[model samples]
Target: MSSYSGNVETGGAPDVRNLPGLRITKLSVGPMDNNAYLLECLSNEDLLLIDAANEAPRLLELVGDRALSTVVTTHQHMDHWVALEEVVAATGARALAHPDDAEGLPISTSPVVDGDRIPIGDCELEVIHLVGHTPGSIALVYRDPKGTPHLFTGDSLFPGGVGNTHDDPEAFASLIGDIETKLFGALPDETWFYPGHGKDSTLGAERPSVPEWRARGW
Candidate 1:
């Protein structure tokens, strides 16, 4: 009964029924080309906007008149929340982020801790706190009804490698450990992940290189 055509970036119509009513729209915005995702639950018309990183106008347009249930900031980094305030103001959505990085965010955000459950209609996403990218960097995991799992790992995990540690030894160690245990060890290889920016990758593809990454000490 909903008429949302989605945005031009989504490319062709997403088969809602086949996808179990889960719709993911990725928009490249801001100076950093940060990816802003619109996760829409077609069954209940529940929308969760992830990382309002920029291009406020386009983000607003994608959101249209639908009420947004939550606006989630994956971390406290400035680039990730450039449009956070504006989008939240426009949509009246609750701003949610990890407590470790909440103070750094431009707007006040409700703290989401590890093991918290975020509901999207009948489905839900489990929060995994990935440190080192930031003290509060977190990833949201959604297990598809059909079996495959989906991960939204802000900047913590990405294709080819983990997020930049900026030469911080302690931070790098923490992030690598978390990625090894929480991400690679916990999730299945076929799990598909959408990062905060850039291309998507699967755990199956990146799992083999874990030793290489550790050897390089990056």
Candidate 2:
């Protein structure tokens, strides 16, 4: 197994313990630097994987001795699920994704919609459907016992700007709107969001740039 560090070359494995009962492990894989996450609910050791982009062996090793309960695909993009089939087959975990992108997946997916609650041991992950990046790109929000929020965003909202809309005006508008209202407007500033690739960011850090992003029409 590769060493557990935040560096991608060393598997980008982070030392668990971002929140009280949440242990987050990140791995950067594939040529695109796709990020795959292992969310361990420490209370009962229940595990939920967000994106299975690549490197099945390393992902499996990250699971260690715990049974992987669910694997949630953030979107239907091939880069985000390159290792989906192998990981699911190895773990026997149910695959969950939005219905819009479910058909693009190689394996059967238990469809998820907005306002759905996915249980992870004592914690519950609230599904927030955000469009524009993809027809069904979704984000998972988990509120710790102390009220701090943790978000798992696929390709929708990133650290700098919203996910690529391919330069379409409407798509860009929709994406920014969803993020502004659903994420920024609703969640607190301290919410830490983990995207499908690259570094994580908090609402407070990125909140000020919303208007600028909208004005630039990106």
Candidate 3:
């Protein structure tokens, strides 16, 4: 994956994080700071809300009535897209997600697949398929002008860990293997990861821990 690091700020509804081709904003709402992101096109004001978890008022206050092109859900977990109805109602936006996760949520979603390009203003978001966390989990990858790649993992990988699994007994090991060999290991140390439920971590910082995770048979 490519690294797309820019300005990540706190406070206000629009916590702007600048990348080469885009500007990212974060909102920590609800019981957890689920890291709902706002990607506004630099060339245009087209907005994309990544994981509409909670704090509708706060998130709306951040976006402030901007017209939204779409809202993307990382998984079927309520915390990830619970606020989708509110967000869509507020902006008349279309909601999208993995086809497998369709029936569980409030709205119909366009199935996100590997290598799909999400257009945000002048920039493009390349889709990275991440499974096992759910049947159809995906990570968003983008490279900035500086060549730094940023990955939006959405509860798949964290600073010093892989992700949490509550499904099948074998899922833990399978997902961990995918993260270690496919997702985490293939990316650059410069890659920055923003998960669905915690603090952000860099690829460089989260790398060595992969082997330990494998040893534990997780």
> What lDDT tens digits, residue by residue, belong to model 1 across residues 103-155?
99998889899999988777788999999989999999988987689899999
Clashing residue pairs in candidate 2 (N, C-alpha, C atoms within 3 angstroms): none
Every model's TM-score: 0.91, 0.93, 0.88
Per-residue lDDT, model 3, residue 145, is 59
- Give candidate 3's error at residue 154 in angstroms: 0.4
- Report every candidate's CA lDDT: 0.84, 0.88, 0.76
Best-to-worst ranking by lDDT: 2, 1, 3
Model 1 TM-score is 0.91
Which pairs of residues collide in candidate 1?
none
**When superposed on Cα atoms, how far off is each prediction in RMSD?**
4.1, 3.0, 3.5
How would you encode candidate 2's per-residue C-alpha lDDT over 1-218 as one tens digit per residue?
53334445334544454667777887888678888888888899999999998888888998887899999999999998888999999989999999999988989999999999998888889999998999999999998887589898889988899999999999999999999999999999999888888878899999999999999998
Q: What lDDT, from 0 to 1, does candidate 1 have?
A: 0.84
Off by over 4 Å in 2: 1-12
Residue-by-residue lDDT tens digits, candidate 3, 15-104: 457665678876666676577888888888888889888877777776785788888888888888778898888888888887877777
> Which candidate wins on TM-score?
2
Backbone collisions counted per model: 0, 0, 14
The list of candidate 3 runs beyond 4 A from truth reads 1-14
